[model samples]
Target: MSDTHAIAFVRNEMLPQAEPPVTQRGLVKWLRENMFSTIPNTIMTLLSLYVIYVLLASVVPWLFNGVWSGDSIRDCRAALDGATGGCFAVIRERWPQLLFGSYPSNLLIRPTMAFFLLLLAAAPVLFSELPRRLLWFTALYPFLAYWLIWGGSIWVPLFTIATILLSWLVFRALESRSFFGAIVAALIVFVVVSIVLGGPVVALLDSIATIRLQPVESRSIGGFLLNFILGTTCLSLSLPLGIALALGRKSDLPFIKGLCVIIIEFVRGVPLITLLFVASVMLGFFLPGGVDFDLIIRVIIMITLFASAYIAEAIRGGLAALPKGQYEAADALGLDYWQAMRLIILPQALKISIPSIVNIALGLFKDTTLVSIISMADILGMTRQRIMNTSEWFGVYWELLGFAALLFFIVCYSISQYSQYLERKLATDHR
Candidate 1:
C-alpha cells in the first residue's frame, strides 16, 4: 500500500490504473494552454475580453433593433432610435444601380450573363471531376465572354469555328510528330487564306472609313464597369509593354536603352490624372488632324503607358536581381537571347516579382478611383451621391466608406496573401 506498491502497479500496467482527470479534455485545458499559457497572453486575453464586452454592449442591441426591420425607407426613418443598425431596404432598391449602373433595361442581361460565364469558366478549377475540355476552354473563353457581353456578327462565330478546326488539325498533325513542319505549314496556310478571304491589304485599307473623335461623346461612357475595364485593360496592355521596356532597358543598343529610360522616367514623373488630362486633350494632336479620338480610349492609352513605366521598373528590378550566372548558363546551353529570356530568365524573374506586380496592381486599383474626378461614375461617385439622400447621414458615411474600404482591402490583401503563399512554395521547391 506504499510507494513500492505504486511503482510496481505503474510498471505492470503502462498506465496509472485509471485516467488522470476528465477536465483535461474540456474548455479548462484549452483555456489554460491557448489563452493563458504565459503572463503576457493572459493579460492580452483579459484586455481583449474587456474590449469585446464594451463593443458588444454597444453593437448587439442596435443591430437587432427595429431599425433593421425596415421594409421601406419610411419604415427605417420611423424606427431610427439613434441606433447603430443599417437600413438594408435602401441597398435593396438601389442594388441594381450599384451593380449595373445605367447599363440599359435590356442590357442588364449581358452583365449577368458575363458573371455566370466567369463562374462557369472557373467551375472546372474548383471541381476536379469536370471534363478535361475545361483546360482548352480557357484558351478561348475570354473571346467567348466578350462575344456574349457585346453581341457581335456572324463572322465571330465563323472565326470561332475556324479556330476550333485549326486547333484539331494542329493537334492531329503534331500527334504524328510533324510538329515543326506542321506549324510552318499552318502559318503559311493561315496567311494565304486570310489574304484570299479579305483580298489584298491595300484593298481592305481603301475600304476602311475614317472618323472624328468627339470629346463629349467619348466621356459619356464612364461608370463603375469602366473602372474594372480600365484596371484589366491597363494590366493587359502594360504587362506586355513593361516586358518589352524591361528588355530594352537591358539592351546593348544605346538608342533603345536611352529611349526606354526616357519613356519610363517621364511616365513615372507625371501623376496619373495629369496623364489622363493630357490624353483627353493632347493625345489627339499627335494623331492625324482629322482622325477622331475617344476620351476613354485615350485615358486607357495613358494608363497603359503610365502603368507600363512602373511595370517596366518592377521587371527591371527582377532582371537585375537575377544572378549573372543565369545569363551565362543560358548561353552555355546554346540558347539564343530570346530563348534564354522566354524559357529561363523571365519565368523565374516574374515568379520572384509576383508580390511586386500584385502591389503595383493594387496601386492601379486605387488610381482607378481618380477617374471619378475625371468624370467617371465609379463606386465612389455612387457613394457620394447616395449618402446625400439618406436620413441617417451622420452614420451613413461610415457605412458607405467602410464598404468601399472593405472591397479594396479584401482584393489587395488577397493578392498579397496569395503572392506570399506562392513565394513560400517556390522557396520550398528551390530547397
Candidate 2:
C-alpha cells in the first residue's frame, strides 16, 4: 500500500501539426459538404451546372462575337452575316450621350471633375480612417457640385455659405443661454442677413455672371448624369429629413406625432410614379404663376419626400426594435431627450436599420430610371430615345440595354458592399 501510494501523474507535450484527413480538407471537402452532401443536393448541383452551361453556350458566343466598332446596326449585321451577335456599336458610338445627355461637349470636364471630387468628398465620411478635416470639404461639396453641374454665379453659393456660417456663429454664441433661444436667434440672424444682402448679391452676381460657365438648363440634363444627380441629391436630402420625420413620429407631443403619421402615410400610400406625375404636371398649379421651378428641382423634391417617408418607417422599426432598458438607462443617466436619442438611441437604431436604409437607397437609385416617363432623358431614357430610336441604331436593343444594366449593377453593387463595410465597422457585439 505504501509503495502504490506514490503513483506518478502523466504529462503530455503540445502535439505537432498534422495534415487534415483527405475527405476533410480543401476543395474536395468543400464540394462534398456544400454541393454533394445528399442525393437531392447532388441532383440540384448537376442541374445548376447544366443551366450554367446552357447560358454560357448562348451568351459566350454572343459576347465574343459582339461588334464593338461599326457605324450602324446594318454594319454590325453585315459583319456578323446573320449570326446571333450583339450590335454593341450603338454603345460605343453613343456613350457620350448616354453619360452626359445633352450637356455641352466642351463643358463636359466640369461634371467629370465634379464626379471625381465626389469620390474625394465621400471618402472621409465613408471611411473613418481618413482624416476628419476632410469633412470640411464634404460640407462644401453640395455647393461646389451645384456650381459645377448647374453652372451659376459663384457669389450665389458664397452668399449661401456666408449665411450658414453666420447662423451657426449666432447659434453657438447664444447656446449657453438656451437651446430654443439660440435656434430662434439663429433663424432671425439668417433671415435678416438674407434680406440685407440678397439684393446687392444679386446685382453683383449679374455684373459677373458672364465670367461663369455657360449655364446649363435643367432640360439639357439627361442620361446617367441625370440619374446620378437625382439619386445623390434625393438620397442626401432624404436621410436627414427621414431622421427628423422618424423622431417626430415618435415624439411625446400629439400634434407632431399626428403630422408625421399623416405625411408618412400619404406619401407611402401613393405610387412613386404618381408622385412623379404630380411633380411634372399638377405641382405647377400650387406654385405662384411667376415662380418657375426647374423640372429637375421639382423631381428632386418629390423623390426626396417619397424616399423620406419610406426611410422614416424603416427608422421607426429600428427605434421599436430597441430594448426598453436602453431608453431607461438613458433616462437613469439623466440624459435629456435629444441627448439620449442622439448619442445612445440613434447610433444603435441606425446601426440596426442600415440594411433597410441601403435597400431603400438602391430602390431609389434604380427608380430614377422612371424619370423617363416624365420625358427626362436618364440613362434608360437616353438609350430608348437618343440611341435606339435613331434610324442607324434601331433594333440594337440588347447592347445598349445591357450596358445600362451593367452600369446600374456596378453602382448598386458598390453601395451594397459599402453598406456591409459600414455594418462591420459599426459592429459592437465583436462577433
Candidate 3:
C-alpha cells in the first residue's frame, strides 16, 4: 500500500457525459419499448401498419376522387368515368334531410338554436365546476327545448313549469312531516294541476300573452335530429328513475324491493326490439279511449324505461361494491337513509357506475336506429326512406351510411372520452 495506492484512491477527475444509445432515447426508444420490444409485438405492429396502409390506400383515392357535384348516382358514376370513387353527391344533396328529416326548411333556425342552447344547458350538469345557478337553466331547458322544437305557444311550457313548481312546493310543505306522504300528495297535486291548469288555464294565458310559432308535428321530426332528441331525452329521464329504482330495490320494505325487482328483471328479460314493438303497436291499446298519444312520446317512454332498468342494475352494482364501512360511516354521522345516501353514498356510487351508465347511454343512442322498423326517420331511417328509395341516389349506400357512422362515431367517442375524463377526475386511488 504505498504512495501509488494512496493516489489511486484519492485522485479523481470528471469524465465527460456520453450520449445514450440511439435505441434507448427519443422516438427510437419509444418505438422500441412500445412497438418492437418483443417479437410478437413487432409482428403485430407491422401487421397493423400494413392494414392501416391498405385502408388508407383504398380510402384516400376514393375520397379524393369522390363526385361531390353531381345531381344523381348516374351523374356521379359518369363523373368517375368507370374509376372507383365515392358518390358523395348523395350526402351533399340530402344533407338537410339527413340532418333534419322533414323539418321545415325556413324554420331550421329553431332546432339549430335549440341544439346550441342544449350545450349551454348541459354544461352545468355535466361539469359541476360551473356556477350552481346555471342548473336553473338546465332545469328549464326541457320545457324551452320542447317549445322551440315543437313550435307551440310559450304558455304551454310556462304553465308546465308552473305546475311542477306548485307541485314541488306542496311536496316541500309535507316533506318534513312524512316522505312517502309528501310524494303521494305531490303526485296528486301534479295530476290535478295538469288537468285543470294545462288545458283551459294554458289556453287563457296563451290568448292574452300570445307567443307562438308555426307548429311542427312529431312526424316532421326525423334524421339525426330525431336520434339526438330520443337519445338526450331518454338518457336524462332514465338516470334519476334508474337511481330511484336501484335505491328502491335495496330498501328494507319488501313491497318496494319486490316491485323494483320485478321491473328490472322483466325489462332485462325482454328484448329492446320487443319493447319498441310494444311502444309502436301495443302501447296504444292500453291507453284510455280517445286519448291520442304521440308516437314519439310513447317511444320515448318505452326507451326511457328500458334504459332505466339497465342503469338501475349498473348503479346497483356500484352500490353493492361499496364497503360496509361506508354505510357505517354514514350511521356514525347520525344521518338517516336519504341523508346518508345523498351526502355520502350516491356520489361515490355514481362515480363507480359512470362507465356502465355511459355504455348503456351509447347503446341506447345507437338503438334509436331501430325506430326505423316502426317508420320513424332517424339518420339511418332517412337514408333508407328518403335517399335509398329515390332514383337520384338509389344505389348510394356507403356514402350515406358512412356519414351516419361518422356522426355516431364522433358522438360515441366524445362520450367515451368524457367518461374517461370523469373517472380520472374522481379517482381517489390515484391521489
Candidate 4:
C-alpha cells in the first residue's frame, strides 16, 4: 500500500519553442519598434512622412521633367512648356568646365586615371583587412598624383621620391641612437641630395621632355579637381601635424606646451575665412621680393593650419579621456616616452578620436569652396561665374547648385560611412 502511493510520478519531456508572433517579427516588427512604438513617436512618424511627400512632390517633377538635351535655358523652358522642370542642359554643356575647369581636353585622361588610382591608394589605409603590400602603392601615390595633375617634368617627382627614400634610410640608421638627431640628419641628407642632383635630374628629364605630358600651369587648375587636390592634400597633412600639436600640448617641457597652446588657441579663435584671406593676400607681403608663391599652395598651407588646430583639440580630448591605468601599464612594461605614446597611447587615443577627425576632414573638404572668395576657380567659382552667369544658361541656379551639393554629399557621405566601418572594425570590447 505504501509502495503504490509513492509510484504516482509522471514522466517529463522538453517542449519545442514556438515561432514569434507575426506582429513581433520581420519588417512590421521593426517599424513597430522604431517608428510607431509610442503615441508621440507615431505623430512624429506621420509628420515626417508628410514632409517627405511634400519634398518629393516638388522635387520629383523638377528632376524628372528636366531637359537633358538643350542648348540654353530658353530651350529647356520651351521643352517643359510652363511645367516645373530643371534646366540640366547647363550641366550637360559645361560638365567639362565643372569637372576639370580649364584643364586641357587632351590631358583629361591624366586626371581621370589619377582619380581612380586614388581609390586604390586609399583602400588599404581605410580598410585594415586589405594586404599591407598595397601600402607601397599608397606611399608612391603622392608623387604619382602630382605628376598626373600638374604634368611637371617626371624627374621632379622621381627626385622627390628618391630624396624621401634616402632620408628614410638615413633616419633609420641614426634612430637607434637618437630620434631628434636622426631627424636632423635626415633633413640634412635630403637637402644635400636634392641640391647635388637637381640640375642633372632636370637636364636628363628635359632630354626626354617629348615623352612627357605638357606641363599645366597651377593657374589652369580649377573646378572640382582643384577642390579635390586641396582637400586631399590638406587632410593628409593636417592629421600628423595635429597629432604632433596634441602631444606637444601635453609635453613636460614648458616651451613645447606653451607653443602648442598658443598656436591652437590663436588659430581656433580666428575664423577660417580670415586665415584664408591672409593666405591669399597678406602672406605674400611677408615673403622676400622676387619670391612668388603659388596661390593654391598658400591656400593649402592655410587650410592645413586651420584644420590642424581643430583636430589637435579633438585628439587632446581623446588623450584626456584615456585612463591613468593605461599610462601606468605602459610604464610598467618599461617602455620609453616615445615608444609608450606610439605603441600604446596613440593607437587607442586615435581610435577614440576617429569621429572627431572625420568631422574635421569633412569640414575641411567643404571649406575648399571658400577658395572661390580668393577668385580661384574651384567648382563653386566655376559654377557661379562661368556656368550660371553665361547668357545661354542664365537663371539656372538650382540645377547647378544641386549638382555641386550632390557631388559634395557623395564624397562626405563616403567618408562618414568609412569612419563608421573603421569604428566597428577596431572595436574590441566584444559587445
Predicted candidate 1 versus true structure: per-residue lDDT over 1-431, tens digit per residue: 67676564335546457754766768888998999989999999999999999999876764565343444555676677565566655555555555545555465676577667766775674356689788677555666655554453324434545755775576567645664456566666665555455334324443463222111222333345556667766877898899889998999989989999999999999999899888867777888867766666777888999989988888888888888999999999998776799999998888766777778888987788787676666667666654435554424554455556776687678657766776776782361
Q: Which candidate has the highest lDDT of all?
A: 3
Clashes of 2: 0
Ten contiguous residues minimizing lDDT sum, candidate 3: 2-11
**TM-score of every prediction relative to native:** 0.69, 0.90, 0.95, 0.89
Q: Per-residue alpha-carbon lDDT of model 2 for 11-91, expressed as tens digits?
A: 688678999999999999999999999999999999999999999999999999988889998999999998978988888
Top candidate by TM-score? 3
- Tens-place lDDT per residue, model 3, 329-425, is 9999998888899999998898888889999999999999999988899998899988899988888888999999999999899899988888888
Q: In order, what lDDT does every prediction score?
A: 0.68, 0.91, 0.92, 0.91
Question: Quick one: how many clashes does candidate 4 have?
Answer: 0
Candidate 3 segments whose C-alpha is farther than 4 A from its true place: 1-13, 37-42, 428-431
Residue 186 displacement in candidate 4 (angstroms): 2.5
Q: Relative to the unseen true structure, what is the Cα RMSD of model 2?
A: 4.4
lDDT of 2: 0.91
Candidate 2 error regions (>4 Å): 1-24, 173-200, 205-210, 428-431
**TM-score-based ranking:** 3, 2, 4, 1
Candidate 2's TM-score: 0.90
In angstroms, the error of model 1 at 93 is 1.2
